[model samples]
Target chain A: MHIIIVGCGRVGAQLAQILSSEGHNVVIVDKNQESFKRLGADFNGITITGVGFDPDILKRAGIERADALAAVTNGDNSNIMVSQIAKRIYNVPRVLTRIYDPLRADIYKKFGLNTIGTTTLVAHIFRSALLKESAKHEFTIGNDIGLVEYRVEEEETAAKESGGGKK
Target chain B: MYVLIVGGGKVGYSLARRLADEGFDASLVEKEERMAKRIAEDLEQVLVIAGDGCDPGRLEDAGIARAQVVAAVTGDDEDNLIICQLARDTFGVPRVIARVNNPSNEITFKKLGIDTVSSTTIISKLIEEEATIGDIFTLLALKRGKLSIVELIIGPKAPAADKMIKELRLPADSILATIVRESHIIFAKGETVLKPGDSIIALATTDSEMALREALLGKE
Candidate 1:
């Protein structure tokens, strides 16, 4: 599959590495040439240095034939614009964007755009960890279906066994 | 009409001031609190709100629901695009205008039915018009910049000076619309004779702009 990923940050680089190693044609774009270093030497994917939302740059990255496009730029607005251009303009099959603002992510979802907001997701994960709950809120499928991950550590099992008598 | 402007940069600030002075209800949203306060103090009529315009909540605070027009003139094209989308799609504003910092993004904005103003395109056109072809000025660009209506003043030594319109070798796509001699407007005809200092208005495609300029103003 031909994949185009905008932004070469940690997540972007990791995704590019995994996809590239899985034998997919990957092209990564970033505004700074230095960001490409995050992909390291083992990565075998094309790197483009230009604004992610610029049509010329995206075309240069072969967006016309891309099966999937991921917009992971730090700027939520940039990611949203790139995702829209890829999905609405180029009609890429799969267009995903990362938006830091939870409000913006929800708004774009209402517009029928695929967006992932890490701010809320990470906060949920941290909150669940801090509360030491076995059921960790991973994500929700929709309004009602919440997918929770259950963790059963040895220490948790021991604590439960010891507190069983007290209860 | 109520106008909501996002971004506190020079364009947004001055636009709000002008709109307020013109008796239109205008409010500006600036992300920087200090700049917003400064602009609020400077402009008594316009309302200034300090918050990121890309955030819908901030736009709501600026009263986007009842805004007749929304203008996003931020330096960042992405932010402007988002703001315009929010204004148009979410709030259903009658008109949404955005500043395209990168000229390449103008098509994207236009495709989404958002009006765009590119300072880069405008400034470059002005510089090129002033530096090389001082007499020929672009009155308006139409058809997505494919066609332009231009005005050119006939110089004393211009090739077309003292010659009839039919005699000049105008570009194939060029059409002379009118000739203004002094303050009187005359509809251009094949038999209309050109005179020095006459301002000629013509419609031509972007590709024919240089040829039309040369035909009227002579090569510089």
Candidate 2:
């Protein structure tokens, strides 16, 4: 899939690197030139420096042919605006935006936007891990389906996921 | 009527003050604390909230759901567009008015169902009006300037004064419509005598304007 990821923050950078490694065409756009440093030296993808929502800049970033777009900019308004432009103006099929504010994220969803709220997602993960006994899955699709343990007090969730060999 | 205005710039501030003066329940949301405080101090009757107007929480706090009309008059076009969209589509505000800073964005705002007031277009029109202001005010210039209705404020030195319409040699295709005096409007006829300080309304074609101006004011 050809993807245009706006913002070169941690999530954007990691997503670009992984998607590019998987042989998908990835283009990362950021207003700051220093953000490209997060992608490392060997990663091959286009980098654009301009406001993400600018129609001309987006066109230059291959928005016309892009299959997906992810707006992960720190500003919620910027992310929402860019996502709306991609979806409504350019008719991009797949559009996603990361909104940090939970309430604003819900509003975006109500407005028919696809929003990923890392704050709420991480907060849920922490609450579920701390409760331990409250996360009762009502149904399981397959025997391999397992909810990996996340340590709320420790940084062991990443290690725990790899250590579990359910697959 | 309840009105919620986004952005506390000069436009929003004056609008809020005027609406409050008219006894409307008006509220203004300003992103800057200092501006919000200053506007709050100046507008005794309007509700002022200090926060980003684009934020849904702040808008809700400012009573967006109950607002009969929402005006997004921020200097920024993008911010204005989003605020109006959110107010209309999300909250179902009955009326939404957006101030479009860029004339090019007016069409986009209209297509999105938000009514826009483009100051750029209005300012351009004002500049056009200033350049054309004279004794002969071309009210309606039509069809590539072929036909027009021009009004002239006749002064005491005007040579057309005390002259009957039929006696004066008005150019062909030009006709007098009305003589607007200080107190009344006189529908001009062939025998009507033009007087000093008479505001003359004439309908003429493009080529006849010079002749009409010369006949009324005596010269260029």
Of the true interface contacts, each candidate retains a share of: 0.81, 0.19
Model 1 Cα lDDT, one tens digit per residue, A35-151? 999999999999999999999999999999999999998899999999999999999988888888998888887787777777887786676567777754455422233445555
**DockQ scores of the candidates:** 0.68, 0.21
Writing each residue's lDDT as its tens digit, candidate 2 over A23-61 gives: 999999998989999999978999999877666778899
- The digit string of per-residue lDDT tens for model 2 on B1-220 reads 8999999998999999999999999999999999999999999999999998988789999999999999999887778877887898888999999998767666556656678898778788668645644578778988745898998877888889988989888899899999999879899999999899899999999678778888888775
Runs off by more than 4 Å, candidate 2: A133-167, B75-78, B101-111, B121-220
Each candidate's clash count: 0, 0
Predicted structure with the largest lDDT when compared to the true one: 1
Candidate 2 global TM-score = 0.67
Residue A109 CA error for candidate 2 (Å)? 1.3
Candidate 1 chain A minimal-lDDT segment of 10 residues: A158-167
The local lDDT score (0 to 100) that residue A74 gets in candidate 2 is: 84
Docking outcome class, model 1: medium
